[model samples]
Target: MFGCIAAGRLVQTNLQQVDVNKYVFELSDPQSINHLVVFLLGTIPFEPGYAATVHLLWPNKDWQLLGGLSNEKPSAIFRIGGGKNNIMMNQPTATLGISIEPIETVQQLLSTLSSGVMKSGGSNLQHAVSMTEVGQMASRVIENLFNYVTSFAVQDLPMNGIALGEVTERGYLPVKAFQTWYNNLSRKLANDPNYLSSEKSA
Candidate 1:
C-alpha cells in the first residue's frame, strides 16, 4: 500500500503492523539524501473514510508529521537534506511511522502537501502530478531541485577558526580535514619542496 523513493532507488516498503491502525518502516540514510518521495501504491486506496498520516521520527523521539497520502492524492515530496529540514541522524538510517487512522489525519496530510509540493514563495522546481501520475515525477523533481542548489537554507560559518570534525554536519571545520590537509602540503613543501618528485600514495 506504500512505496518510497530514496536517492533514486525505489523500494516497496513492508509495513509492519505495530497497532491495529499504526504501521512502521525504516528509511535508510536520510542524512546523506537530498529528498524523500513517499506515495501510496494504489493497490489498496483509502476507503473514503479512512486515511494515512506519515511521520518521520525526530531526534528527540517525537513523531513529527512528514506528510500524508491518500486515494485522491498519492504522492508527496519532503526536503530531508541539510536545509530547513536539517534531519541529522545518530546512525545512518531513520524511522518512518505511518498511521492510517482518522479523517483528521487525511486533512493534515493534504493541508500541507496540497496537489504539489512546491507552492510558490520560492522557485518552483516540480509541478504537482495527477492521481494517474503518482510517483512518476520524483526524479524530475529531484533534478529540478538540484539546479537550485544555492537556494537551500544551508548552515554556514560566519567567520574562520570554527573547530569542526568530520562528524559535524555543518561545514565549520576549523582544523584537521582542511587545515591538516593544507598544512601537510605546506609542511611537505617546506621540508622537501620535491616531495611530489617521489611516488606517493596512489
Candidate 2:
C-alpha cells in the first residue's frame, strides 16, 4: 500500500504571494518489498533538515534514513529482506517519508525581491552604491545560511555503517549536533581571512 499526504500554508502579499507545501508519504506491504526505490521529482525547493525515513518489517527489523542527493533530481533505494522466502508479516507496517516542496514560495520570494530592487532604482545603477551594499549584505546572509547548513550536514553525516544504523534507529541527529558543528565551522572559517578570500574569489 502506498499513500501520499500534502499540505500547504499560504501567505498573502500586495505584490506577490507564497505557498509552502509539505508532502508526507508512506508505503506498506504484506509481501516483503525487497528492492524499494523512491524518486523525488521536479525542481521543488527543499526544506532544511528534511529527511526520508524507511522502516523494514522483516526477519531483521531495521530503519534507514535516506540521505539527500547532490544532483538536481534526487532518489534513494534500499534492500529489505535477504531471501525470497522471507515475508513482511507485520500488519500496518509502514515506511514514512517527508518532502518539503517550496515551489510558489520561492518564486514569490524572488519576484518580491526583484520588484523591491526595481522600485528602488537599484537596477539602474552601474557601480557600487547604497543599494548594492544592501544587496551584498543580503547575499552574504543567504550564503552564510547555506554554508552553515551544508557544514552541519557534512559534520553530522554518519562516518561509518554503525553510526548510520544508529541514525536510522534515532530518526535523525539532534538539533544540537547541527548547531554545534555549524557554529564551530562558521567560526573557524570566519577566523581564516585567507581561506575566506580564496573562497570568495573562487
Candidate 3:
C-alpha cells in the first residue's frame, strides 16, 4: 500500500500480493515524470542465507541492482534516479522490472560480464541502441508552474552504500555495483537539500 499527498490531493496505491516474487508497474506516458521514488515494506526474504538484492530493469535493457533488504530491515524507501545515475525514462516500450536475489551472486554475475567470462547473449546490448530509430522526439514551450517541496527523506547515503560495505568486506565489490552506488549518490546529493545546505553552511 502507498499513498502520496500532493497539492491537497490524496493518491493511494493498493496492490494485491498475487505473486510472491514479481511486481510490475507500467507507465504508458513518461513525459511528465521528472522524478520517481520507490518503497518496499514487509517481511522481505533473503536469498538462501545471503543478503537480498533488488534489481531494477528498464525497457531499453538498462538494469541496476540494489542490495540490503531482508527480514531484519523490512522497510526501504528510496528516491530513484536522484543519485549519480538518474532514472532512465521514456522509450518506445514502458516497463519496469523489480526482483530480489543474493548480493554475492549478483556481484559474480556482473564480474563475469566484465571479465569476458560471460559473453553477451547475441548482442542484446546492440539491439537496445536501435530502439530510437522510430522518431520519438519532442520540443516544448509555454508557461509553467512549479511547486517546490523543501523537505525530503535521506537514506542510503553512499548510493547503494549498504551493499558496498557488505560486498567489499565479504570479498570483492562489483565494479558495476560501486559505480551504480557512487553515481546514484552523486546525483541524489545534487538533488537533495540536506546535502546542499550542509555544503553551503560549511
**Candidate 3: C-alpha RMSD after superposition:** 16.6
What candidate 3 gets wrong by more than 4 Å, as runs, is: 1-20, 43-52, 60-93, 107-192, 195-202
Task: Give the per-residue lDDT digits (tens) of candidate 3, residues 47-122.
Answer: 4543333344555566654322333333233223422343444443333334444545444443443332222122
**Global local distance difference test of model 1:** 0.54
Q: Candidate 1 — which residues are off by over 4 angstroms?
A: 82-90, 108-202
Give each prediction's root-mean-square deviation over alpha carbons: 17.9, 19.3, 16.6
* Sliding window of 10 residues with minimal summed lDDT for model 3: 138-147
lDDT of 2 by residue, 120-186 (tens): 1222211125434433433343344334434434334445523321222223333454455445545
TM-score of each: 0.50, 0.27, 0.33
Show the colliding residue pairs in model 3. Answer: 81-87, 82-187, 82-188, 83-184, 83-187, 83-188, 84-183, 84-184, 84-187, 159-181
- Pull out the clashing pairs in model 1: none
lDDT of 1 by residue, 1-202 (tens): 6666564443434567788887777766566666667766535777666667778875566776765655645666666663335557444667778788666645644456555452212111233444223334443333333222223323665454453322234333333233334354456668876554444411
Indicate whether candidate 2 or candidate 3 has the larger lDDT: 2
